[model samples]
Every structure is written in C-alpha cells, then in structure tokens.
Target: MKLRTFPQGVFLPHHKEDTAHLAIVRVPPPSRVVLPLSQHTGAPLKPLVQKGDTVKRGQKIADVDAFVAAPLHAPVSGKVAGIEDWAHPTLGRFQAIVIENDGSSEEFRYDPLPEDIESLEPESLRLFVREGGFVGLGGAAFPTHVKLSPPPDKPIDAFILNGAECEPYLTCDHRVMLERAEDMLLGLRIMVRACGAQRAYIGIEDNKKDCITHLTPLVRDLPFPTEVIPLKTKYPQGSEKHLILAILSREVPPGGLPLDVGVVVNNVQTAAALGRMAKEGIPLVERVITLSGDCLKKRGNFEVPLGMLLEDLVALCDGFTTPPRKVVMGGPMTGITQATLAVPVIKGTSGFLFFAQNVGKPEHSCIRCGRCVLHCPMRLLPYLLGRLAEEHLFEEAETNRVLDCVECGSCAYVCPAGIALVHLIKLAKFEVMRRRKRGGK
Candidate 1:
C-alpha cells in the first residue's frame, strides 16, 4: 500500500533505535522542582500559593482566568519553597514556583468520570479537562480544552490523533502507543465527544509499523469510526497541518488552523494523558519523556514529574558518559537548546537531547542553492524570506507569507550554505507578529 504524506518534506535518520523499545519508567521527584507559570502559550498564570504553603500531589498550584491557558498542578507532595525567577527551557527566565518535596505521598483527588465517559455531557468533560490542566503534549502546549471547544459556526467533522512521532530520537509517543494503547483510545473518544466530531483517525508513520499493527485491532471497538493510517515516514509528518493533509487531504490556509478545515488534531501522548487523568483521578502532573542522547550514560523513556529539574534527570541517567556540547529540550528538529541544566521540564517537554560534539557550523552567503525552498513543507519561499529578514524588510516578508513557516528546520537541514534559514525566518516572523500587534501592516 502507498503510505500517505504531504509534499515537500525531507526524510532524515530516525535515531530512535537506542530507546524505541524501552518501557516508560516512572522517575521519582527531585529534591525540588521549578514550575514555570508561563509553560502554556496563553497568559502567564498567577501563583495560587505563596512561600511555605504545603501542597499535595495533584494540587492546583497556579492558574489564571484566561480561557486559553492551562493551570499548573503540583506533581508531588511538597512545600512551596519560593516563587521567584528561574531559568526556563524556552524563555530565558520567568517567575516559577519552587517546591521542596516532602515525600509524604499525599495527594489531592478529583471525582473520576464514570466508566462510560461518553455518557457525560460534553461541556462537563471540557470543564473537567480544563480543571485538570491539560495541554498539547506535542510541544505546542496549547490548552487542550480550548481545542475541545471550537466556535459553534465551525463544526468539526473529523479528529486526527497524531501518533506520528516523526522527530528523530523522540520515542515517548511510540512507547505510549505500544504500552498505553487503551488509554490513548479512551482519550481519543473523550476528545471526539467533546469536539463533536463524527469520525476519528490515528496517523502513525510507517517507520513505527508496530504501532499501526498494535492499534489497528483495538480501535475497532471505539464508539465512532476510527482508522489507523500508516503515514510515509517523513519529518514534520506529526505537524498538525501536515498530518491533517496526509490523513484527510485537508489544507489549512495560511495563518489558519485545523478548525478552518473542519478538523482537529492532537498528539497521541496528549490523548493518553487525558485518558489517564479520567481513569486515575490525576491531572497533568507528570508526563513521559525520552531521555537519550550520545552523551548520556543511560537512555530510556521515563514518566517524569512536570517540574523535575534537568540536572536531577541527568543524575538519574547515571550522569553523562562524555562532555556534552548542546542540550535540547524536546526533539532536535524543533527543540530549544538549553544553556543550563538548571531548568525544569514543563508540560511541553518531550525529551532532552545531549550531543557530545558541537553541531554548529559557520554560516556562509547563500549560494542560491534553493534547497530550502524545495524542502519547505509549508511551500513558503524560505530563501526569499531569509534575505528579506536579513535586510529588515519585515513588511515584504509578511507580504510573502513568511509567517506561515513552521520552523521545522527542513530548510536549515538541507541548506548547503548553513545560512540559518530557520532562525532568519523566525526573526522575520517575530517582527511581523510584533508589527501586527502594534497595529502596523
């Protein structure tokens, strides 16, 4: 059978053999955790507890009134040590609530939903998800409840479960699919009901044949029509837009979202987490992450507390086997490089990659190879956007639809000139968004 995929994507090494088959182990909480208030994309949360306040596992610690934000919950029983500035994986520094683990194993619980979750009202399910502090585990960290509640004018007909763990070396989703297939399916059903979708689909890359085979038979019993699609193993196949196109041949317009195309997409991990939340009466406190890289002594998938420090996680891996050059929080392609290990893993973190050798290369003038344009999944002119950005021509870049660039690093990976096309396009995108915010064209 011909596997489905979108056009203009590059296939790279999978780099997943090291830990792909490993089962997810639950790591104990560190001595302390740093919970950043701004982990989600929307408004930053305000601390609900001050210094010296004792909190239990699964306790809500910080939240805001914003509809687009997810609340923060304590992953372990602890005392609020302080609420102050700390190093963030993506943001340089942000106000974080530090908690010192007391190891009492005490927890706060919510009334778990009935076994037949579909019997519950959709609005009630959305409220439960919101209160549980669920977000997209697929890296965007957008609030999950918001996706469940689209505008009435835009009715959703299809929901896509993104099992395409296409990013190199990140196998947490793969492990989740294999180990927690039932929970993932349950979550998908809940999400489908909440979003009012008529049909559902699971898109897993062909590289993970085991996942497709494993999930195919299980989805047969779902209340709604659900199919497991084997996508062509391509980088960024897990991307929301691309996955939609691959599974349903739907195109999300420039600056538009899946809802515009009458669809919604979510990571398999996100669905599994929600399933667990409903079953276990727990919120989004801990998540599975891949802890593998060339420099680490140990490598495997782990269900780690949300705010566990990177340094502690490294220590659990028996420390590094070699001096590390670059540390990234998430898959290498779209992950953010970390300057220090002091930062804590947030809801959006998928994995930590440690490379022994520096991967930076000297930038050169674009030889006009046009490799970036050829491989750009969004079909944007990256070379033109990069040049326009370098010249500070934000208006022209925006006019050319530079904001559509997904920063998947396809252009950068294929660039012979090492021109940092993604970075330049990112800069242009930032400038364009800033100008629009300032009421400029």
Candidate 2:
C-alpha cells in the first residue's frame, strides 16, 4: 500500500527500539516540584499563590491575563516554598514556583462536565479548554484554546490529529496512540466541535502499522467522518505544516499556520490530554514522556507530573549507565541541549535524551552538494542562509526567507560538509525576529 508523504524529507534511523514497546510507567512525584512560569509560548504567568500558601493538586498556581497564555497548575498538592530563579530546560534560568509536597494527595477538581462534551456550545468548550490549561502536547505548547479560536474570516474546515511520532527516539505519542486511543478520539471530537470542522483526520507514520490498525476502526465512533491516514515513515513528518501537506495535499504558505488554509492541526497527545481533563475533572498537570538514550540505565515512557526535575527523572531510571556527554530536552532534531538537569519538566517537554558521547562533528566549509536544499522540507536555501548568517547579514538572510526554516536539522544531518546549516539559519532567524521586534527593518 502506498503511504502518504510530503516532498523532500530525509528518512533517518527511528532509534525508538528501546522504549517504543514499553508501557508508560508512572514516576513517583518528588518531594518538591519547581514550576516554571513561562512554560508555554506567549505571556509569562505571574504567581497566584504566594510563598507558604497551601495548594492542592491541579490547583491553578500561576496565571496571566493575556489571551495567548495558559495558566500553570499545581501538579501535586503542596505548600508554596518560594518563587525564585531556577534552571529552565530551554531558558538558562527563569522564575519558578517551588512547592513542597504535603503528602496529602489532595486535589482541586472542577465541576464535571457532561461526558458528551461535543454537544456543548463551541464557545463554552473553548472557555473550558482555556481554564483547563490545555496546550499542544506534541512539543510546541501553544495554547489550545487560541488555536480553536480562528477568526471568522478563516473558517476551519478540517481538524488533523498528528500521531506521526517522526522524531527519532520519541515514542510517547506512539504509545499514547496504542494505549489511549479512546481518549484521543474523545478529544478529537471535542476539538472538531469547538472548531466547527466538517471532518477530522488522524495521521500516523506507516512504520507503526499497529497504530493505524488500532485507530482505524475506532474513528468510526466520531460524529464527523474521521480517517486514519498512514504517512510515509520519514524524519519531521510530524511537523504541523508537513503533516497537513502529506494528509490533505495542502501546502501552508511560508510562515502561514494550518488555520491559514482552513484547517486546524493538533498532536494526538494533546487531544488525549483534553479527553482526560473532561473525564477526570482535572487540569493539565501531568504528561507522558519518553526517556531513552545511550547513557541511560533504563528507558521507557513515563506518566510524570509537571515540574518534576530532570535529575529526579534520571534517578528513577536508576541513574545513567555511563556519564552523559550531552543531555537534550525533547528530540535531537529540534531539542535544546541542557547544561544542567536542575531544569524541571515543562508543558512543552516531550522527552529527555542522554548521549554517552558527543553526537556533533567539527564544522566544515559548505561543500555545495545541494543536499541540504534538496532535503529541506521547507524548500529554503539553507546554504545561502548559513553563509549570510556567517557574514552577519541578518537582513539579507531575512530577504531570502530564512525565517521559514523549521530547524528540523535535516540540513545538518544530510550535509556532507557538516556545515551546521540549521544552527546558522537559526541564528539568522533569531536576529531577524529580534530586529523586527525592535522596529528595525
């Protein structure tokens, strides 16, 4: 059977052998959790709970008035120890709310909504999603309520649930697909109703045929027509733009969102989380994450409370088999490397990768093999962007559309010269955005 795919993406070793088959284990919560204020994209939240205040699990502890932001919830019932600077997984250091577990296992439950959530008014559903702190769980962590609220001019026609699990060594979504298929479907239905989509689709990589088989029959339960699309196994296939292209034959214009094309896309885990929230009367306080790499003693997927530190997670795996040369949050393709494990798990974190040795190579001059350009899913001129960045010509890079680069690292992965094309392009993109923010052309 032919599998759907986007053009110009490179295939890589899946590297999911160690944890793909493992069931998600619930990790014990640490005595204290360090909740970062700016875990999601948009405005950073300010503490709602002051130091020494007692809070319950699933209680809203931090929030901001901005429409683009999601509130932070207490993952475990605890007393607010302090709010201070702490190591962040992406940011070097950020303000965090430290909570000391009170050992009561208390919870703050919202009034239960009807099980038939899709029957509610769309506006009501959006408000509930915002209150629940729902965000894209596949890694971007953009507020889900905002995504569901496209302008009237951009009416949403379809909803796509991403289950590609395209990044190497990340199988949290894959496991979620197999184990929580019903919950995912429930969430998908709610989203479709909220977005007033005519139909919904779930896209899974063909490499995981079991997931395709498992979900194909289940989608029949949804009110709107929903199909399980098997995407070709390729790196970055899970990218929102690429997934839309592969499944719907739609190309999102450069810097355009899925909504720009009358479609809304969300991760499978995000949908599942929403389903869980509706069913359990809980807020977003935990997530499933994959832990795997060469240096780890044990590896598998885990259901972890938010704000648990990476150091505590590593210890649960029985510590490293060997001292890690590098530790990365999320996947290797676009994940950030961490200098310390003091960082706590934030909403956007998908997994942690620990490598025994440096996976990087010394930079070399661009060999002009055209491989980076040939394989870039975005179809941008990465080599040209890299050179422009090296020359500190941010404006030139911007003119050439460097901001369109998704930083999937396909250029670096396929580069014969190891030119660090993604890094250079990222720098150029950052500079361009910084300049634009400062009102510079």
Candidate 3:
C-alpha cells in the first residue's frame, strides 16, 4: 500500500520486535499494590476504605462524587495497609492506597451473564460502563463515560475505533485486535448505540496486516456499518487528530477536538473492556501491558493489575539483564520517565520500558533548522516555540501556536543539533495555558 502523507512526522526506529510477536502474559500480583487515588483525567476519587480495612477483589476502594471521574476498585483481595504519598509514574507524587495482598486470588461475586445481550438500553449500558471503572486504555486515561456522553447539541455521525497502535515497542492493542476480535466488534455496537452514531470504522495501521486479516472477516455480519481502513504506518498515526485525518480526511482544527468534526474515537481495548463489562459486569481491574527494552532479560506483553509496581513486573519478565539506568512508562516517544521504579502502573500505562546507560542524551541546542517545522504533524513552528519559550516570552510562544503542539517530539527527533525543542515547547505551552486559565478568573 502507498503511504499516506501527513503535514509533519518523523520515522524513528520502532524497536517493537522485542515483544510484538509474544502473546500477552499475566503477571502474578505483587506482595503489595499501591493504587493511586487519581488515575483518570478528572478530579481524584476520595478513598472509601481506610487503613486496616480488608477489601475483596472487585470491591470499590475509592470513588469520586463527580460524574466525570470513574470509580476505582481493588484488583485483588487485600488489606489496606494505609493511605500515603507514593511516586506516580506520570503525575509524580500523589496520595495512594497501599494494599498488602492476602494471597487469595478470589473472584468477586457478581450476577451471572444473561443469555440475551440485546435487552439493555443504551443509557443503562453507559451507566454500567461508568460503574465498572473503565477508562481509555490507549493511554489518554479519559473517562469513557464522559466521552460517550457528548452534548445533545453535537450530534455524532461516525464512531472511529483507533486500532492504530502506532507507538513503538507496544503491541498490546495489536494483540487485542488479533485475539479479541469478537469482543471489539460487540463493543463497537454498544459504542455506536451510546454515541447514537449510524456507522463505525476501525482504523488499523498497514503494519499489522495480520490484525486486518483477522478483524475484517469477523465484522462482516455486524448490524451496524463497519469498515476497516489500513492506514499508512507512521509514528503518531495513532494520535486522535492524525487518525481522524487519515481515515476521514477531516482536520481537527487548532484548539479543537475529534468531536468538533462529529467523530468519536475509542481504542480497541476500551471497546473490548466495554463489551466484557456490559455482559459480565466486570470492572476495569487488569489490562495488558507491554514490558520490553534492551536491558531486560525477558521482553513481552503482560496482563497486569492497575496498581502493580515496575520492579515486580520487570522481575516477572525474568528480571533485567543489567541494572536499568532509566525506566519509562509507555512508549519511548510520548511516555514519561519515572524518578524511581517504585512508581505503580496506573490505568494509562501501555508499556514499561527499561534502558541501559548507552541511550543517547537530550540535544543541547537548535541550529535554527526547519526540520522540526517540516516534520511536525500539527505544522506549527517547534523551533520558534522553543526559542520563545526559552527566552521566557510566553505570550509570543502562545501567539506562535505552542499549545497546538501535540508533544510528539518529532522536532526533537529530527533536530541535527540535538535541541530539546519538544521539551521547551511543552514548558511554554503549559505556562501559557496556566496564564490563560488564571486570566479568565
């Protein structure tokens, strides 16, 4: 297939061979798990259970009064050790519920599955999803219910399932597409009903021909209109904006969203979870995580609980061949580096990558090269944003569309001078957004 052209993007070494072929493995729960109070994008849930309290598997441990946030459940039967501050892999330090495992892999008692799945209403189905604690497993961690509940004024026309696992070194979604085809399709039906859309499309990158081959046949007899488009394999092709453009040829304008174009995008895993939740009433307790890197002895995907630590997960993957110099949660491009291995994996963690000391350092300066601008998918001036940000000209940076940068690090990757353009632009964008929010007050 001929590759589709986007405004700006860079081709980096995928490094996905380390684990892409491996089937998903289940990691044994660690001795203790640190469940963060806040995992989704909205407000943090309040702890419902305190220290010394025993919680059963699938029991609600933390919940928020807000509708925008999903409730959190215990992944295992355990006693709450205490509530304390712990290192969050993405959000830094935050209050977390530490639970010591009781060693019983007990399943929670819930209603048995009904033989007929078509009896439920769309609103009831959405409530079930919210109650089940599901979030976007594709790493944005937005509450799924909120996304389903688009405003009445904005009528949705098409629902897009993002099967584009474009990130390097992570293939959990690919595996899900290949292995969980039925569940994904059923979930799509539910999502179509929830969003009140007439048709749905599954956008998969051409790199995974196997997935396309597997899913195309299964979706043939579906009630709703379903089409699977083989997208051009490119870095950040899985991003919401780019995916919209690739499949539908619609541009999500500056400071706009996929919804603005009457489209709703959901990850395959999220849909699979919804399918399981609607029928089985199971909550989002565990998910598939890709654990791979150069320094690790074992590299593959693992089905792990939300609160497990990196050390325990790495140990299960046969431990590291050499002591890891740095550990990052998720794919290398968009994933954040952890300050310590002790940080627990939250709902958004798609992969845990370990690197040795040989990895290259960040670039020192920009050579005024236009490579960043040329490769940026957003088509914003990353080099100029970096300069404006560095000089503390926050207003100029905003005017130059710093906030529009997706932080995909395309500029940093293409920079011959090794300038940390992405990092500087991100800092400036943050400051600008903060100032704007403050000024509104």
Candidate 4:
C-alpha cells in the first residue's frame, strides 16, 4: 500500500520519547473533583444538584435542554459541595460543581443495552451516545452525538478514525491505541455503524510503528470494510480536513466540515470512549492525559478523572525539573499557555506540557518571509492575513480567507523572522466571527 499524506505541512519533532514507551498508569481519583458545566463546545450545562445534595459515581450531576449540549457525570460518589464559578481549563472561568468524595464508589445503575449492538438501529445508537455525554476527546470537545448524526441530506459514506498524535509532546492517543486497541475498534465499529457508513479507515502516523503492527491483524476479520492506513508523520496531519484529504483524497470546502464532504472523522480516544460507554455504561467522566516535556521530573501517560486541578497533576509528576517558564495544555504548537494552575482539567484535556525559559526562539518582526504562506495546509496566505489582523482589519482578513486558517502553527513554526502569524490570525478570526454573529459587516 502506498503511504499517503497531505501537502504543505511541516515535519514536527514529536517529543513523545518520554511517555511513548511507558504504560498508562491509572491516576487515583482526587479527593475532590471540580466538574465544569461547560466542558464541551456547545451551550453550558445547567446544574442538576444543589448544595448538600449527595451524588453517586456515574450519576448525571448537570444537564441542559439544548440538543448540542453534553451532560456531566459524577466521577466519584460524593456530596455536592457547591455550584460556583471556578477556574476552567479552556474557558478561563465558569460555573462548576464541587464534589467531596466520601470514599464510597457507589455508582448509579447503567441501563442495559441490546445484547447484539450491531443489530441496533443507527438512531438507537445515536441516542445511547447522547445519553452517555460523549464528545471529541481529541481536544475540540464537540459533542459526539451531533457529529455521529449528521443531517439526513448530507449522507456520510466514509468514516475516518484519527490515531495520529501529530502534535508535539502528546502521546495519550498513541498509548490508548496500543493498550486499548480492542476497545478503540469496538468504538470505531459503532461509529461506523452509527454514521450510516459501510467503510471505515483508521489512520495512524508512521512514528507509531507499534500501533500499526498491533492493529493490522485486527481489521482483517472485521465485519465491515475497515482498512488500517499508515500516514506520513507530519504536523497537523491529525486535523480532520487534512486527515480526510490524505486518506480519501477529498477536499472539505472552506468554512465546511467533514460531514459536508461525505466523511466523518473522529479521534482514536473518542472511539475508545464510545466503546467503553456502550460496553461498560460509563459516561465521559475521565480521560488519558500525556504529561511530558523537558521541565518535568516524572513523565508518562495517565488516566485522570475530569476536573482534577493542573496543580495536582504537577504535584503528581514530582514538580518540574526547573521552574517552568511556561506550562501549556495539549501540544507546544497549538496548545494554549496556562495562566493559572488552579484550573481543573476538562473533557478535552489531552496533555500538559512544561517548558524551561531557554527553550524556543524569541519573536521578531515579519521580514517579508513567505514561509507561512508556503506551508499553510489550507493554502491561505497567512502572512497577508497576519498583516491585516495586526492592523485590526478584520473584514480584510476575512476577505483574504483568514477564517480558513486551521491555526496549525506551521507558518509560525517555519517563519525565519519568528512572526506570531497564528496569534494575529486568531484575533482576526475571533473578531470576524463576533461581528458576523452580531449582524455587522
């Protein structure tokens, strides 16, 4: 088979050596977990419990009436300490339910499902996913059910399972694929069945040689047409659009989605979570997180409960090798720099990265470098977009297709002058969307 890849992406030095070989260790549930009501991409969830209300593990503590919303479940059997504004991993600040663990692991009984899930209807499978509160564990945090059930007119013909941990220093997905191959496949099978697609492809980067070796034989006997694809290891190869382009040679139009192109893409962990949810009746309460970088003493992949504080993770990792100048959530290129350690990990927390002060190049003025334009996966002129954004010309940036930018940081990575092209483009995109939402030009 010819190994395929998308064009114009930069080669990333995957800083996954530390945790790639380490077995995933189960993180003991914290004494108290802070469950954010807005862990996902849609509308915030409403608190379902009041102060002094006792809750059990796997009990739905918060929910919303919105179709796009994904509910939150209790990670441990505990009492509702309070519902108050708390620091969130991505949202900065949001209301969260504080639960004090009482040492009892009592769980609410899960409703039994049909013995043979393959025989169930797609709508039935979708309902199960929605009730289980599944979301994209690959960092976007979009509700999984919404993605699973696309509009009827836009029929899905293919399903792509993303196993490319292309982001630097993140290996949680890699570890998940190796350890939970069966579970991942189980989820992938359901996802394939749910999306009304008969063919599914699982894409893993070439760097994860062991994963390819482990998964190749499993698909041989699959009931549906499932193919294991070995992708070129490159930055942003895991992005839905790029993955679609590489695997199927199809282009998802600008300002569109994988669904628009007759394809449904998902993370490897997301599939695993779905498999676990359907099989074990567990909702999205915890996830695997990769903690690795030059500034950490202990580094490995861990299965941590949602809403555990970053400070707790730091402590669990034995603190940093030196006082980290920066701590980021996710990968170094696309991850956001954390402002405070008080924030709790949410459903989308993929990895925690720490870096010493001396690590990267300092920013400088753009020196007419066209590298950003040349390497952009979307083929948008990032340098021009950055210039327009710097001038606060949001309309101009949008006209130049700034909204098409995937924000992969490839331009910034390759820029000889160290221009913060991605940052400026993000600012422009934010302003553009804000204006568009308000009916402004």
Candidate 5:
C-alpha cells in the first residue's frame, strides 16, 4: 500500500533507538507524592482533604463544582502534609497537596462493578467515568466525561482512536497497542456505545508496523466496525486535526474542534484506561511513560505512579551517566522543560527526554528563508506571525489566523535561521485570548 503524504511537515531525527525495543519496567513507589489540583484543562479542583488527614489509594482528595472537570485522587496511602504552592512543569507555580507515604499501602473501597456494563444506560457509564477521575491521557487532560457528553445539537458520527504515535521518542502508545490490544478494542466499544457512533477507526503511523500487525487480528471478531488505517509517518500526524484529516479525509476548520465535524478522537492509551475503569473498576493511578535521552545509561518505558518525581524515574532507569542539560516531560517538540528534577509526572506526561550537555548554541535571527512557512501544517505564514508578534501587532497576527496555530514546533524545526516561530505564535495566541477576555474595547 502506498503511504499518503501531507503538506508542510518536517522529518527530523527520532532519537528513539535508545529505548524502542526495551520492555517497560515498573518503578517503585516514592516516599512523597505531590498531587496538583490543576492538572486538567478546566478550573482547578478544590481540595477536599485537609492537612494531617490520612488518605488511602484511590480516594478522592480534590473535586470541582463544575461539570467540565475531573476529580483528583490519592495515588498512594499517605498523610496529607499540607497544601502548598509547588513548581508545576507546564503551568508554573500552582497549589498542590503534598502527601507523605506512610508505607501502609492501604487500598480504598470502590463500588462493585455491575454484572453487565452494556445493560447500564449511557448516563450511568458517563457518571462512572467522571467518578473515576478519568481525563484525556493523550496529553490534553480534558475531562473524559465532558468529552463524552457532547451537546445534543452536535451529534458525533465517528469515534477515532489515535494510535498514531507520531511524536518522536515516545513509544508508550506503541507498547500499549502491542500489549493491550483487547483492552483497546473494549475501550473503543465502550466509547462507541456511549457516543452512539456508527463506526470506529484506529489510526497508526506506518512506522509502527509491529503494532499494526498485533492490533489487526485483535478486532477480527464480534461487535462494531473497527479498522486500522496506516498514516504517513510525519511530524504532527498524531495531532487531532491532522489525524482526522489523514484518516477520514475530513478537514477540521480553522479554530474548530473534532467535535465540530461530528468526530470524537481519543488516544489509544486513554481508551485502554477507560476500558479498565469500566470493566475492572480501576482508577488511573499508574500510567506508562517513556524515559529516554542521551545522558542516561539505561533507557526504556516504565509504568510509574502519577506523582512520581523525575529524579526517581532517572534512578529507576539506572541513573544519568552524564549531566543532562535539559529534561522535558513529553517529547522534545511540545514537552515543557523542567526547572528541577523534583517535577512530578502528571496525567499528561508521556515521555521524559534528557538532552546531553553542550548540544548547540542559542537561536539566531530569521533570514527570511521561508523554511518555516514551507513546513507549517496549518498553512498559516509562521514567519509573518512571528514578525507581527515581535512588533506587538497582536490584532494583525490574529487576523492572520495565528490563534489557529497548533504550535507543533514544525516551523521551528525547519527554520534555517533558527527562529523560534512556535514560541512567537504562542505569545500571539495568548495575547489574542487575553484581549478577547477583556472585551476587546
């Protein structure tokens, strides 16, 4: 089969060879874990527990009054030291509940799973998801229940499973598909049932041929229509808009969501988590994260707790051989740089990349070579956006559709001038949003 190609995407070094074939290991529990209240996309969850209170594993410690949010749960049996402001890797400083492990390993009681899930109503299933503290594991961290509960006017016709692990050096989804094929299928079925969608499609990048081979036969029998479409191995192909376009040939309009086009996309890992929660009555405490980069002696995927620190993960991966200049939470392209090793891995963390020392010099000036424009997937002029943002013409940048930019870093990757186009676009988007919030008088 011929591979389909997309416009304005770059092919950079993957650097996944170090841990591509390594089996995933389980990291031991840390003595202390910091649970942030603002891990998801909506308002910060209100703390439900107070200092000196004891919490067991799977207990709900924080919750919100809003519908577009998920409650926070205790990952381990511990005592609440206090609520304090901690360094959040992505959101800067935020209030977090610090829990000191008491070494009890006590498990909290959960409601018994019904005899048959299919017999339950869709609303019941959605309630279960919300109570389980489920969120978009693919990185967005949007509440899963809210995503399932689309407005009545906008009906969902298709449920797309994002198996396209196109992010460089991130193989957590790849391993999930290969190992938990049945779980992925079951999760898709749950989603299909909940959304009342007609069909489901799993899109995998052509690079993961082994994953495709493993998932093909898993969905052969019973139930709904499920097919695996091999997408062209390109940067940002795993993005929601790009994946929808690549698989279904449907273009999500600028500044529009997949839901706008009658589609709801979920990550393969998120689907698997959903399946486990619905079937086995489990909450999301542990998730698979890829730990790799140049400075480590060992590199591989590990199923670590939600609040595990980067320092502990490094130790589990056999410690750093050389000092790492930069430590990112996700893939290098979109991941946030960690200020210190004490940063905990939140729900959206997929990969921990460690770059070697003395990598390269600082970025240089833009020479107007037009490489960024040539490689932008959104077809927006990144150079123009960057220039306008630099000149502080926020409205001009918005008129040029700067807010629609996905910030996938493709423009930065292809810039011969070493211009930081993604950063500039981000700044412009922030300003536009801020002005709109102030009523834009």
Candidate 6:
C-alpha cells in the first residue's frame, strides 16, 4: 500500500533506533523539583501555595482563571521551599515554585473514572481534562482542554491522533503507542467525544512498523470509528497541519488551525495521558521522555517527573560518555537548545538530547539554489523571507507570509550555503508578532 504523506517534506535519518526498543522506565524522584507556572502556552499560572506550605503528590499547586491556561500539580509530596524566579528550559527565567522532597511520597487519592464516560457532556470531559492538568505532551504544551473545546461555529468532524513521532532521535511516542495502545485508544475516544468528531484516525510514520502493528488491533474497539494510517516517514509529519493533510487531504489556511479544516489533532502521548488520567486517576505529574544521543552511554526512554531537573536526568543516565556539545529539549528539527543544566523539565518536554561532537557547520551566504524552498513543507519562499528578515524588511517578510513558517528549521537544515534561514525567519516572525501586538498592520 502507498503510505500517506503531505507534500514537499524532507527525509531525515530518524536516529531513533538506539532507544526505540526500550521500555519506559520510571526515574527515581529527584530531591527537588521546580514547577514553573509558565509550562503552557497561555498566561502563566498563579502560584496557589507560598513558601513553607505543605503539598502532596497529585495536589494542585497553581492555576489561573484564563480559559486557555492549564492547571499545574505537584509531582511528589513536599514542602514549598521557595517561590521565586528560576531558570526555565524554554522560557529562560520565570517565577517557579520550588519543592523539597519530604521523603514520604505523601499520597492523595485520585479516584478512577466511573464505569463509563458515555454519559458525560463535552464540557464535563473538558473539566476532567483541566483537573488532570493535561497539555499537549507532543511539545508546545498547548492546554488540552482548550484544544478539546473549539468554537461552536467551527465544528470538528474528524480527530487525528498523531503517532508519527517523525522528528529524529525521539521514540517516546513510539514506545507509548506500542506499550499503552489500549490507554491511547481510550484517550482518543474521550477526545473524540469532547470534540464532537464523527471520525478518527491515528497516523503513524512507516518507520515505526512496530507501533502500527501493535495499535491496529486495539483501535478496532474504540467507541467511535477510527483507522490507523501508516504515513510516509517525513520530517514534520507529526505536525498538526501536515498530519491533517496526510490523513484527510485537508488544508488549513495560512495563520489558521486544523479546526478550520473540520479537524482536530492530538499527540499519542497526550491521548495516553488523558486516558491514564481518567482510568487510573493519574494526574499529569510525570511524562515519558526520551534521553538518547551518541553522547550518552545509557540511552533510553523513561517516565520523568514534570519538574525534574536536567541535572538529575544526567546523573541518573550516568552522565555523558564525552564532553557534551549541545543539549536540546526536543528533537533536532524543532527542539530548543539549552544553555544550562539547572532548568527543570516542563509539561511539553518529550526528549532531552545530547551530542558529543558539535554538529553545527559554518554559516555561509545564500547561494540562491532554493533547496530550502523545494523541501519546505509549508511551501513558503524561505529564501526571500530570510533575505527580507536579514535586511530588516519586516513588513516585506510579513507581506510574503513569513509568519506561516513553523520554525521547523527545515530551511536551514537543507541549505547548501549553510545560511541560517530559520534564524532570520524566526527573528522576522518575532518582530511581526510584536508589531501586530502594537497595532501595526
């Protein structure tokens, strides 16, 4: 069978074999955790506890009234050591609530879901999602409840479960699909009910043959109709717009979302988290993350606490085999590079990658060969956008739809001239968003 895929995506080395077969292990809880309120994309949550306050595992620690925000919970029983500015993996520095482990994983009961969820309304399902502190585990950490609740005007007819895990050197989703297929299906059904979607599909890349083989049979018994789609292994195949096009052949307009095309997409890990939250009463305190690269001797996937420090992971993995060159929070294609080891993992963290040797090549002038344009999944003119941004022509870049760039680094990765096309585009995107916020056209 011809596998489905979006057009014009670049092929990657995958780099997932080292940890692909490994089972998800639970990391020993760290001595300390720093729960940042800014884990989600919306407004940062307000701290509900102060210094010296006692907290229990699965206890709600912080939240906000913003509809777009997701609540945060404590990962382990502890005392609030401090609530102050601290280093963040993605946000640089943010106000974080630091907790010192009390040695007793003091328990709070999380009641299991009722015998059935069919009796629940969409709003009720979203409430459960928010109560569990769920977000997109695929990274970006967009509040799951918000995604589940779309505008009434734009009804979602299809739900796509993103099992693609297309980014290289990351296999947590693959492991989740293979190991927790039942839970993932349960979560998908819940999400489908919440979104009022009539049809569902799980899209996995062809590279993960094991996941497809494992999930196919389990997906048969879902409450709603669902099919597993084996996708062509392509860069950014897991992204929302791309997956929607691959599965449904639908196009979400520029600056629009998947919902605009009568669809909603959620990651496999996100679905599993929701399912676990419902069935086992497991709050979203811990997440399965991949820690693998050529730099480390111990490479595998593990269930890491939400706020565990990077230093703890390094120590648990027995540290690096050689001097670390670059550490990233996600996959190389779209992950953020970390400058410090003091930062804690947040809700959206899927992998922590370390490379022994610096992979960067020297930057060069654009040769106008247009490899970036040819391979770009979004089909934006990256060369012109890069040049316009480099020349400080923000208006021209915006006019050319530079804001549509997903910052996937595809342009830069395929550039023969080694031009930092994504960097320039990122700068332009930032300025464009800033100017728009200031009421500029």
Listed in order, each prediction's TM-score against the native is 0.98, 0.98, 0.95, 0.98, 0.96, 0.98
Off by over 4 Å in 2: none
Looking at candidate 1, the ten consecutive residues that score lowest on lDDT are 358-367
Model 4: CA > 4 A from native = 358-362
For candidate 5, lDDT tens digit of each residue in 147-175? Answer: 78878898988899998877789888888
Cα lDDT, all candidates: 0.93, 0.91, 0.84, 0.88, 0.83, 0.90
* Residue range 180-207, candidate 3, lDDT tens digits: 7877777888777877787888998887
Please give the distance, in angstroms, between residue 347's alpha carbon in candidate 5 and its true position after superposition.
Answer: 0.5
Local lDDT at 425 for model 1: 93
User: 1-441, model 4: which lDDT tens digit per residue?
Assistant: 467899998987787888899999999888888988998899999998999999988999898999998988998898999998998877778899999989897987467555466788989888888888888999999998899988989999999999988998899999999999887888887888889987999999999989998999998777788889999998899999999999999999989999999999999999888788777888878899999888899999999988788898889998987988888888888887888888888889998888886355777787776888778999988889988999899998888999999999999889987788899999999999999999977
User: How many clashing pairs does model 1 include?
Assistant: 0
Q: Return the lDDT, model 3, position 206.
A: 81
After superposition, the stretches of candidate 3 with alpha carbons farther than 4 Å from their true spots are: 1-5, 109-119, 361-364
**lDDT tens string, model 6, 145-264?**
888888999999999999999899999999999988878888887898899999999999999998888888887877778899999999889889899999999989998988898998
Clashes of each: 0, 0, 2, 0, 0, 0
**Candidate 5: worst-modelled 10 consecutive residues by lDDT:** 109-118
Order by lDDT, highest first: 1, 2, 6, 4, 3, 5
Task: Write one digit per residue (lDDT tens) for candidate 2, span 301-371.
Answer: 99999999999999899998899999999998888999998999999999999999987677678878899
User: Positional deviation of 243 in candidate 4, in angstroms?
Assistant: 0.1
List, residue by residue over 1-441, the lDDT tens digit for candidate 1.
569999998999989999998999999778899999999889999999999999999999999999999999999898999999999999999999999999898999888878897788999999989999999998999999999998999999999999999999999999999999988998998899999999999999998999999999999999899999999999889999999999898899988989999998999999999998888889999999999889999999999999899999999999999989999999989999999999999999999999998776787888888888889999988999999999999999998999899899999998988888899999999999998999956
